[model samples]
Target: MEEESQIVFILFAGAFLAALMATFVVAMVILHRQRQVQNKQKMEQLQLEHERTLLNIENEIQQETMSHIGRELHDNIGQLLSLSKLYLGSSKPEKQAEGRELITKVISEVRGLSKTLNLDWVESISIREFAKQQLDRIQATGFCQTELDQEGDPWELEKNQKLVFIRVIQECLNNAIKHASPNHVSIQIIKNESGRKIIIKDDGKGFDTTIPSKGSGMTNLKKRMETIGGEFLIHSSLGNGTEIKLLLPN
Candidate 1:
């Protein structure tokens, strides 16, 4: 009887152990599935944020282009039209010829401006070319001297990525001009097997690095770079100059 009792107890213990083991396995599977769902959600959220950021950038670019067009129409085209009207009013053929020439120039400028009305320019222009154009515009301002240096062949970046870089670089230059009152601004592009680096340096009244920024510009820029698997680094100090480095992987 005791032997039978002992056998029955052993069987019950074994059954309980088996049940525990089964429960553990099921729990582990459920936990793994839960984690997978959480991870997937996180990834989808990141992707959505990235898309929104890109869209915002494109919109900002469009707005800037429109502002530029408005300025051109007011400052340049308006002046040219007024001058042409004056010349065309003249009785002399020479004045009329000059007026016609000015009209032709106005037409060409309009066509060029029309081309930039769309966002296609974002895809059409290379990073190097865009940088050069920005620098040229700055130099035209006569507020600061500008230079661009390329060490190696330009790397072909995705249109979206290139657009981000352009916006960021433009922002940096703008900040230097608007806030730093930089005397000289320089942009250097270096590409190699490892990666690409764009360094923007300015001789300006730099701010202290330890001081917190008054705006969200720096944070936004850092997030923008992180979204694209790149980095934005800034260095500055009072009485010294400012430098921004944009690093991108191959």
Candidate 2:
């Protein structure tokens, strides 16, 4: 009878151990699946955030372009049209010829401006070309001198990445124009085996970096750079100039 009892006890113990092992395996599988789901959710969240940022950038660019177009229509195209009208009204052949020439020039300018109306141009334009365009605008302002220095070949970036880069550059230039009171602004783009770098510097009244900013512009710029897996850095001092550096990994 005792031997039978001992056998029964052993059987019970074995069953318990087996059940425990099974439970452990099940638990591990559940935990692994939960982790996978969490990782997937995280990835989706990041992707959504990236898309949102891109949309915001597109909207901002569109608004800026529209404002620019308004200025051109009022200040430039309007003047040309008025002049063309006066010339065309003249009885003299020379005046009429001048008016026709002006009209041709106006047509070309309108065509060029119309191209920027589509956001698709943003994706098609190269970063260097965009930089040159921005500098040209600044030079047109007559408030600041601009220069672009490049070394090595430019990197072929994804469309989204290009947009972020262009916006960041725009912000830097805008800041210089708005607050920095810089007489001269310069940009340097370098790409090689080490990495890619863009430096925007201005001879403006620099502020103390240690102090906090009242505006979100700087924070926004940093976030934009982070979205692209790039880095944004600023260097400045009082009475000195300010310099912004953007770095990208290979």
TM-score of each: 0.97, 0.94
Model 2 over residues 1-250: C-alpha lDDT tens digits?
A: 9999999999999999999999999999999999999999999999999899999998898898999899998999999999999999999999999999999999998998899896889878888999999999899879889999999997799888888998899899998999889889999999999788999999999999999999999999999999999999999999899999999888
In model 2, state the lDDT of residue 199: 96
Range of the 10 consecutive residues with the lowest summed lDDT in candidate 1: 154-163
Best by TM-score: 1
lDDT of each: 0.92, 0.92
Runs off by more than 4 Å, candidate 2: 1-5
Candidate 1 per-residue lDDT over residues 11-95, each given as its tens digit:
9999999999999999999999999999999999999999999999888889999999999999999999999999999999999
lDDT value, residue 2 of candidate 2: 100
Model 2: how far is 118 from its true place, Å?
Answer: 0.5
